[model samples]
Target chain A: MMRRILSRPFAPVLALAGLLTSLAVAAPIYNAGGGAPRAVFLELPARLPEPEVALRADPLPSGRWRLTLAARHFRFTDICVLEAEAVPLGHAHIVHDGVKLAAAYAPIVDIGPLPPGRHRIEAVLRAQDHRAILGRGGLIKGAVVIEVPERAGGV
Target chain B: MLRVTSSSLKSGAAALIIFATAPPASGHEAWLLTPSEIEALALTPVPFVFASVAVLGPAAGLALLAAAVALALEGRWATIEERASPWLRGLVPSLGAAVLRVGLAAMLLLAATGGLPRHGTAPWTQSTLLVPDMQLSLAPGWDILIVVQVALALILLLGIGTRLAGGVLVLLSGLGLWVFGAEFLSYAPHFAAPGLMLMVIGGGAWSADALMRHDAPDPLTGPAAEALWRGARILVGAGFVYLAVAYKLTQPTLLIAILDHGDFPRFGMTYDVIALIMTGVEIVCGALLVMGRLVRPVALVILGAISFLAVVLGETPLFHANLYGALFVFALAGARAPGPRPSRAAWRMA
Candidate 1:
């Protein structure tokens, strides 16, 4: 039995099996305890009242629209520009019809005047790293829909 | 009986991980997500995740033992490897290097033109240096990078001034870090790895440089060659480790969210479980590359996973074109020095 197990073919096959195990099982466990210092997403628990946003869009004279946001429990700040900490203080991402339009650092931002149709604008709360912040049930976001009427409306 | 049980458990764990590794992926970087999509991800909830130390400890031990056995088995099959690996070790490295150079050219061209624009930006509207996340528009006066990228693409495509191009890539990665800050962390090491490899293995047979400088000497014979080749492997491995740790392990919600957003095929694993498995596999693969064990196979597996993610995520493969090129080089050249290693062709180079 020993001789058979020690044979070249058998030994090589055994080694290959061992290698596969090592790659699949061991390495992942080794690093389970270690993680990057900062987390991009910040999860606010149910205990903290969920933050909310309400968006208002005004057609500007320059074929653009200015957006104003009203918040209930969140504060907007640009202090966490370089890092993604699990902090609620950061900018909001302005999303236009499922496309991220811009980062609203303050209470207001400027977006497009649209191409003359109905449009949906959403404001989602974000952490310092641009990661969406999650509240009690889901994403802390608010939306508003408006009609562009015509391309010449804002212009 | 306990010993038998332990042995069985080891084999079972190995088999289980193997089964899980198949078709295991979520998606590549979803840096272009809009606000609504991000919100949906924020709402995406993971049902359950399995992280019992009881299972992990034994399996991890078995794997460590296996790695040791594999290391011991390395280079023991010189006769078989000498005959079997000539094609893999000889023809493929040069060919793979060329492919990397060409792939890099394509990526650089895309960066200059913003060809793979996603979500918010239209094609040709967003000009980033390397990734969509690194938009050059964020920094004024850096529009010069467009011309620089175009020039680099042309140079890389032709395979001339290849080493100089690699240096430029390294410099650009450093510059991106300075300009974009830590946001560039996700991309810096990955870009630097390819640049370093290009510097070491410049313009293989398929380049204008090779054609023009006929009979160009192989750079593999020097002592520095070994170190440079190893450097590329280490960098790629480190990139994997960093990504797994920063994005997946540390911020698992992000990975779970990405999986949800991409609607990745679960294969019966929960999104969180899938995230855990992916995280673990990346760590193992990356560690293998760094340790110079079973490099070709590990690289091939990583490539397959990346390709799968691209298809499932409905994104252009160009999103990870740079990684594709770097992995191809690794799969072909492997962890061994190309030829005449001061040491034996470490582990057959296959």
Candidate 2:
């Protein structure tokens, strides 16, 4: 029955117009036009020395996990700028279980006494412009999966 | 802090802004998440976003300027069309139809097979529809929809039941909207425009439909048919405009990210500058299409641009199979109609 109606040439015109209209009517409202947020990425230029990074997480006493970032040819800077840096260094995006947890300005990061379960933590090397720095093998970063055993008091 | 308010959306255009605002920045995000990016993108806070004054002001200005220039060129092109006889265009009359059929067929085939996934992912694993976002997994009765989609693709290929296939194309576009809602906005118009075009033109000279027809064909000549074709062209143009604004202008991060991902070489220019220029050119091309001015050139430019992206990004040509065919028709057929065509917007104003 639907096919029969669709077979008509006019049906498509109406349907498409209707769809377009519907979309325009239901746009997400943002306080934009004055200032809409734009993501700016600093692309690593060709022939640049690629920086590499590795992660090592140690469980601290207070249920806080301390992560030590071991990086090569890349410096972890405290400079919070939106421009491309002179060298491949800015900060790191510490992702906890798939969500962006925090931007680590320095090498070491202390993450939460996360809920008692397994957590997949990833640290991606980011340039000054917040782009995940890319190397030959792919994103110049490191990741590790950790399991948080249930504490005595279920805390 | 980005403020998202539903109260701002009193009309459809307002909603379009949001729809345009919320696209993921690039294939890089997809790489990070391993193809879960599309799902993640729908949960937009700040992904590939750019509706800022810096970008939109210039992009919108470029579109307006392009429309003005195209309106001017429209007169000269019409004169050239009246005088110069292009032998390849409509010479066979069915060649355009045949080309369109084959192009759409290939796209549908790729989509049905997931031969052309939107993300740089394993084929047949993610995409099973015309565009990347319209995942078959998201739709209800997708199992049935896939069969219908594939069947339509086959029919369009064979040119056995073309008008019916075109009709199905329209329905499929509608179905995308029904299932995916606003997310489908970028793709729906492009698909439906061609679908309507196919319906109007039928399967040109080489199609099985043409073979079956005993009487003289009357598909491309009439005033109504010509108007529909013009309308279809405008719709295609508008789709381009929407994409240019929504993706490139508003959400420039994605474009930049993709360019960066491919290590798109800059001729001593920053990625931002290059991104701005690309956005401007796309707006111009889309505006020309909408104005029906310099259509052949516009079509060629679009064809070249999409082809370049596919090659540079290492994507399959079949990803934009529909566009290739539609552009081919425009390049060959030109914008002139067989009969008395509608006047330009300027002429009407005069």
Candidate 3:
């Protein structure tokens, strides 16, 4: 009677058992490849230091210059540049600084070649609404000397 | 009977094992992570491994413990069962069934208030249909659903309208399946045992369904009828587990992902391993449930497996709703009085 009781339920049980055993033994494998590229990582300080700027100058083959500036702790929603000579501050254009090229809110910007010589690059931080100067006034400034290496082989 | 008892003991041991192995909840016991961590994990995808295990482990332990206790005390004379008048013998099952229903409702309520609200808009109150967009709109018809679910829970708990209540619960399960989509998909593999058990078995000896049967002729009183009912339940349970395993096999990445994440510090190695082990255990339990050799033991294992998947996996709200119904059936299965005498004519037909 006990055997009969136990035996009655075997067929379905065995079937399920077989199925589970097969799955466990087979064990699935996943392809680790085929995923997206990593994004650039930036580490910014919680608050920027006061208005300090640094610059590097690269001379292009066309004799135009690219000046990259890094400003420390200057916060702005938008960025703009005014020619050093034209500014109301009466600050003299240091030297051969040219037309303002491009402006950005982040610490980096590129300004170009006037007559290649010593020049002042002024970076101004502006408000989001574009109405006012960011801090006490409109301006933060940095300067770099650009000496285009004279072309060696060119006529 | 010995086999059943041994199986029960084994399940109880398994529960104890899981309970002992699980880590204490994190100091940061917040259900959701901080925004910074969310962003980082989204980019890295490493944290999910630990998080999944941590959530699933304790739930498994609790579920197993519940199953063990249920199995151990099954058919044993308890105050509720003994005091129940012969006429109210059916009430025993009804009360157990009620507990299952009400307890599930209570758990869902707690989860909705405590956890779900933090992540996204409440399903009932949210209007926007898009789940991922974080737009919160109350689900259309949510009020009626909640009201009816709560009412059914109350009726089941009160030992009123066993069959009709069970039927409504079955329907609710279907509705729940529709609304919760992906949220339910994560726990889809674990749905079979309880889903089948409840819908097929109709609350055992302790349910209102059984109580109603007592007053009326119960077809379930017959050995053949009882066997057939159990058989149907077993088949459903087995089929669910089989399908889940088969589906998992097709998606190897999920298994690999689970394994890769196994080393996460918060989830702990022991519990993570156990979670993986449970996948196999469930498949075996489901098979055993269907085979019907050691009905009691197999049922206990399946119950424990379900509990582990639900509680430790932290999927209680999603699956517990169905568990309420399944437990009602389990309670009845465990509560059969030791005789062949038909309690009512209805039982004979069943």
Candidate 4:
């Protein structure tokens, strides 16, 4: 009888049916759920390096002011920073006259034509998740004063 | 007079203040980096050349290091196992299985609770859908699905109707994959494999099914049950091994990036070397699990590591799910229950 069952073409079908029946009788549990979102990481200033930023702006031949930024106590990874936490490894967000400019990954960045007046350019060190890197005092930021001289033709 | 204790206390207080008030900073987006990007990061020259060297050696070097450790401990491992077996063998397995069942049931209940804002969390509410296109929508027959999910979990937890629960789980998981498309396959295959395995084994001797059988002899104790257990083990083991290789070994740049993100490099240790060491441990543990060598110990170690990562990397629900799966593997491997002979009705069809 066993041989007959094994030899039959419907053996696969029978086996599947039995397997399904057994499973049905013995109910099991699985994981398909999600969990609440929480803060990714916390960086204490004691463990953090005193991040410093220096900014330089030079008039380019193309008429745009080329801004060069040198950051100390920070690292950059083009890798996604939203999920993982790394200390001191993050990008810099540039701000001009309190208006948010752009997030920069590289040291050298180009700034478009600024109005001929005194302006403040700030480089703020940010964590990988885009939160501003903070010290006990306040945000880790550096500012440089730039004077955009009036062009050859006065308005 | 300046005392050493006073100086230490001052520094400790300063450190405490720093940690207590520090605001959490945003980190990287959750995603896997490509192999090439990782390679580039590993080879990138930095001022800390020595640190880079520590992290940047060939994979063969790691393999050799592992082999050396194994060879050194070869003689003692057997003796250690012999000594530990009597005490460690009996209690851990059964307890681990019960925990696994409860954990799995809880996760299922959470999933069954349906999508957000009702679920009120990303991992729970958004877990049922992946990408915008799969269109499993938050509404519709979610009520029915929740009812089924709760009923099945209760049956499985009681161990009274495990086979039925397993069948339903298999069907549900299958349907989930079909609806969610192949993208979500990587997320929950571990849950599905164990469901089928339990169906074959009839929830072992500790279950209500066993109590109902009441010395009638468990048909699952036969060769078929053994095969099912082995299959489940292999599936889990293989899944972990693949992750170890793909995420840790082949593309350690990503690991380095994560370590760097954690500010691990500040302690004068090379993140690259740290990455390599972590990868090596993952590979060795994963391989041991796959080969069914020292299964209980390996599972425990992997479980510990994963739990730690879940906390350190971020406590996502997915990580919690993985933890439950590891616990199940531990139960399956450590269990040594006596079961009665198979009932004729079970094998009647054959």
Candidate 5:
């Protein structure tokens, strides 16, 4: 039986089958818990461009403020292909006074209901996975200050 | 009994690994089609499918070992080829052309009506160019280009001036690529396939060009025609399958992530669920092409899906190439053979 299995014709097939069987039974191993696959991470190389972000703010009568964002050397995609996270394509995250706001899909976004005071707002472009889009120029960021009047039924 | 069961289990696992890795890694680059975009996806968690495949190395080895035994048992390669030749010849050009032609028309219509980037203002369209000044000026030109493209697609769909329309599409795509630079060169295969098909067939038998010239010889009659037609259908099918499995199934992170970008009309389904459905649709379309069943309509639907995807995700060069090629093929090879449709031809052919 061993001789028959070791023959040229059966050897390759046996080897292939053996390998496949092992693959089916073995569990996946990773260096980090729930981290990226090793092969995928291996393919990633450093290729960065100077991506810059700018912000423009306007107040609307409907008790909400609109924020417009622009970026140079970057583009945004509605869907983030995690495999494409290294690329300079992602949406912007709005930061109001150090608190994280919603993600901005387009160049313009509307933000809301502020008390009578001045507030600082910042916009940062993030990668597909919600990480910051950073290059040699550092993180892509823009900031602005806006004033809002108190509501009619203010506390 | 236990030994036998354990052995079978191992064999199954080995085969699984081999099957999983057989397809090439070409599809994962949907996002990384350009050099600059490579880093964007590299940092994210590996797509689940890819990650799974990556860990199947040992099984892959055993699968390779087992393939030899299977192949030996299968035997008589010449006999198999002889049996398949007639089927291949019958299916290639005739059925293949019909499917491609119809697919092309639907895709053209979609592009003309704004399913894809007929203009230069879109991110994928403009991303090809690094020059900000040139990007600004390209928008007006793109507007004109869209109109012209629409006219050509309509003409092609009607089977009028098929060759001319195809030639122009090739030129337009080429010009676009030239402007976009080498970053998009890899997409040439998809872009050029249709133009080459049109040029080869000129105007198909059912086309307006043929009707105008009664004496025109049938372009798909030669022995080589069989291979050509079969190749076309297979190419389209393979492309679809690749996109469905590789891009959608393997790289679903992007699709899921995009859900947060905007409100999509999902008809009560979540975007993630919708994405799976779309993937299933793509696979079905691809399978239809491979089986040469409902070629025209399925191709058209596939084109529409591609168009919709292009619009939402932005048309990458890959998307552009697929759209361009599908249009060319559709114009040349209409939905079905140019006579009373045979109801069970695809089944018979299979």
Candidate 6:
């Protein structure tokens, strides 16, 4: 009985073991790095060679203020705009802040033609690989303070 | 009388020990699925569970019925002299039964394969086809290989050449377990349970092997033979179950930190619930399988649960393998064998 049981077969067992070992070795590599390539913006020039700067706002607001500013190689996806707390200033916040929004992958828009007031603007970039943000992608620039004088009859 | 009773008690006890010690579920990781994905696949827990129970439960029940009928007929026909030459009579039915079992197994395999694409991404497709970074070949050719393996399993189940067929099925199942090992291991309880079941119990009395055994001595009669078969089964079953239980007991601790920290990719409430339920089912099924009493019924339930999960949770190859294993066991357990016919002295003792 012992012999019979022992003698039953070994070929299949060995084959299966070999197959399992191969699959085990292969699965992890596929799952870890399977997305799009990573990208980071090192530096952006303040003004592009060609610019009547293209500005667009996402979810056009009849009532709210928000927009994105892009020109040449610098394109922003889903930038948020807020009313400038003071006169002649505009503020922009990056929508997936600190994350490199995958090129057009992050739905950002440009908004403008502002009623001038003090404004703050920020930009961030995220890596395309699993959407990780590069280190300190956030940037704050432009009108920290703006003063628009009351002209003629306008208050 | 006391000896007979004691032996029965001992056998029953051994069966219990074997069942209880059977492995807990371990193997194969399922694809990360969301509630929306499950819904999109039109797989709700209730209907899938019902379909699973319906297919395997009835098959098991019928197999048991057939076993009971065969046992009764064996007893009544024991005295008949050469109704059709003993070899021919035995060989024909054995062949027919083997063919039937193989045919049924084939149909089930086909259905299972056909059902794969409709569900959300299978591990094979995700790992090989969709994910491009890996160097592995999607080997869409392997799908054909899988079909051939199923075909081989059918041939084996049919009992055309009992031992050879069993051996082939075993190989095919093992290869399947390996290729999809990670996936099955993650869902270990579900796949391991059925895989072990089939590995241990070949196509039962309904196969050609049983037909060949028509005139042979009762396998359970000799202590040595019984011990060998019983011990082998118990050791394998216990080993499998122990690993599973240990894994289940430790999974929460291992995964909780990741889940709570939100560091783990694709963690969700539904996946957690499914994992917990599966763990619970594995513990219970492992216990029941080792026990061996009402084995058919317990197996039926386990098979149903697996099938339900397969559909509702999205298709995993392991579930299909498990379903086949359970179905085979149910059929074998149900095959008719003679009840003990009492001798005059035995009757007097009783």
The DockQ scores of all candidates, in the order shown, are 0.16, 0.06, 0.03, 0.03, 0.14, 0.02
Give the poorly placed runs of model 2, Cα more than 4 Å off.
A1-142, A145-155, B1-70, B83-88, B214-218, B336-350
Where does candidate 5 stray beyond 4 Å? A1-155, B1-44, B47-54, B58-99, B109-148, B167-176, B182-187, B199-206, B213-217, B221-350
Judged by lDDT, which candidate is best? Answer: 1
Error of 2 at B255 (Å): 0.6
Model 4 in CAPRI terms: which quality?
incorrect
Residues A1-155, candidate 4, lDDT per residue (tens digit)?
A: 32344234333233323322221221111001111011222234475667777888787776677777788877765543323354777777778776667677777777777777888888877665554555544456677887867772112
Task: Give the per-residue lDDT digits (tens) of candidate 6, residues A1-155.
Answer: 22232222332122222222222222222213221111111122334221112334433334333445553332333322111111112222233222221133233443332343433333323222112121222222211122323331122
Model 6 alpha-carbon miss at residue B58, Å: 37
Docking class of 1: incorrect
Reference-based lDDT, residue B208, model 5: 66
Q: Alpha-carbon interface RMSD of model 5?
A: 12.0
Best by TM-score: 1
Score every model by TM-score: 0.70, 0.60, 0.42, 0.49, 0.44, 0.35
Q: Candidate 5 residues B117-163, lDDT tens each?
A: 32212433432211111231333345565566567667766667665
Better of 3 and 4 by TM-score: 4
Query: Tens digit of lDDT per residue, candidate 1, span A17-104?
Result: 4444443344345335432112334665447777888989887778888899998888898654434445457778887788777888
Chain B superposition TM-score per model: 0.80, 0.77, 0.48, 0.63, 0.44, 0.41
Isolated chain A TM-score, each model:
0.69, 0.67, 0.36, 0.65, 0.63, 0.24
Q: Per-residue CA lDDT of candidate 2, range B203-320, in tens? A: 7767777678852243556776677677778778877767765666555545665677677779898777687678667756764565455777788888998888778877776657
> Which has the better DockQ: candidate 1, or candidate 4?
1
**CA lDDT of each prediction against the hidden true structure:** 0.67, 0.62, 0.38, 0.49, 0.49, 0.33
For candidate 4, the per-residue lDDT at A9 reads 36
Residue B279's C-alpha lDDT in candidate 6?
41
Backbone clash count for every predicted candidate, in the order shown = 0, 6, 43, 45, 44, 58
DockQ of 1: 0.16
